[model samples]
Target: MSIARPDLPRRLAAEALGTAVLVATVVGSGIMADRLTEDVALALLGNTIPTGAILVVLIMVLGPISGAHFNPAVTAVFVARRELAAADGLAYAAAQVLGGLAGTLVAHLMFEHAPFALSPTVRTGAAQWLAEAVATFTLVAVILGGLRFRPEAVPMLVGLTITAAYWFTASTSFANPAVAIARSVTDTFSGIRPVDLPGFIVAELVGAFLALGLMGWLLAPRKPTTVPVATPAE
Candidate 1:
C-alpha cells in the first residue's frame, strides 16, 4: 500500500507541528514528573512512558505527511540516502529547531515559568558523549532496520527503542540535536546546559552517519548481472 506524499510546504508543517508536540511532551512531562515525585528514578519513569507512547502516535499520524523526522539526525540520514533533497532537509532541520524552541516555551508557560532561561544543569564528559553516540546510532539503526523489513512497525520500534535508551544511556538519550538545543533554553527538568551542547551534537552526528553507513551496507541490494555466453563454432 502506498502512502500519500505531501508537498514540501505541508511536509514542513507536519515536521514542525510534530516536533513541537514531541518536545512539549518531553518537557511538560518532565516537569510534571519532577513535581509529582521526589525519587529521581520514579520521575524518570514518568517522563519515559508518555514520551514513548506519544512518539508512536506522532510517527503513525505524521509519517505519511512528513516522514515524521523530528530530528536533524534522522533528516541527515534520509538526505544522505538521497531519499530527501538537500534543500528540503535543511528546511526540515530548521523547522524542527524552531518547533523545539516553541515547544519549550509552551511547556514553560504551562508550568507558569519564564518563557526562556538558560539551563545550568551540566551534561558533559566522555561517558555522556559516548552514550549520546550510542543512543543516536541505535535510534537510526532501529529506524533503518525496521523500515527495511517491517515498515509498519517503525513507529513502535522507534518509540520503544527510545524508552529503553532513556534508562540504558547515561545522557538519557537526548539523541536529537534540536531537542538538545531547545532543552538548553529551559531550566526545567528536561533541560541541558547550553555549554554541553557541542559535544552532544557532534556525537549525534557521528552516530547518525555511522548508522547510515552500516545500514546502507547491510541493506544493499544484490544486483543480477548477465554473464556473456560464448557462441558455439559451426
Candidate 2:
C-alpha cells in the first residue's frame, strides 16, 4: 500500500493552529473563572473540562493533517519512537510555540489585560517543576500506551488522560510545554511566569524521554527465528 509522504509544513501548521485554539480556550476560561469563583478548585474545573473536550474534538478535526501534537514533549517522544521524522518534529515544535504566543496575545486582549497573566518572581517553584515532570510523564504514557497501533483513538484517549491528570495531579497538570508558555502570557488563573518556563520545559522533556525509553523496551521487534522445518518430498 502506498501512503503519500505527509507534508511536514502543512502538518506543522495544523499543530500550531490547533495548539493556539487549545490555549485560547483554556486561558480564556481561566480568566473568566477568576472573576466568577472564589474557590480555586471550582475555578480549575471550569478551565479543564472545556479544554479536555476541545482537545478531543480538535484532534479529530485536525489529526488527519497534523497528527495533533500540540506539545513539544509529545513531538519529542514521536521522534524518539521513529514515529515522526526529526525535521518534522522541529517544524511542528516551532509552529506550536509561535501559535502559543499568538494565542496568549489574543487571550490578553479578550481578558482586557495587556500582559494577560505574566509570570511572577516566585512563579512555578520546585514543586511545580516536579509536578510538571510527573504530569508530562503521565500524559505521554497514556498517549503511548493507549494507542500503540490504534491511531484512531489517540486523540480521545490523549485528551482524557490529560483531563484526568488535571483532576488528580498537583500543579493542575501542565502536561503540555507549549500550553505552559502560553499560560505565562496571561495574568489570569491559567498564567505562569516567564521565569518558570525553562524549568517546566526541561522537566517535561525529561519525563517524555523516560516514557520513550520504556516504550522502546516494550515495543521493540522480536528477533526472527533462524531454524526452519524441512519440507516433505513431493
Report lDDT (CA) for all predictions.
0.95, 0.82
RMSD of each: 2.7, 3.1
Highest lDDT against the true fold, candidate: 1
Q: Which candidate is the best by TM-score?
A: 1
- Alpha-carbon runs more than 4 Å astray in model 2: 1-6, 115-117, 121-123, 221-234
Residue-level lDDT of model 2, residues 11-106, one tens digit each, is: 878998998898888888887888898998899888888888999998899888877888899998888778888988888888998888877887
Q: Which residue pairs in model 2 clash with each other?
A: 116-186, 116-187, 117-185, 117-186, 117-187, 119-193
**lDDT by residue for model 1 (133-203), tens:** 99999999999999999999999999999999999999999999999988999998899999999999999
lDDT of 2 at 133: 85
Candidate 1, position 119, lDDT: 96
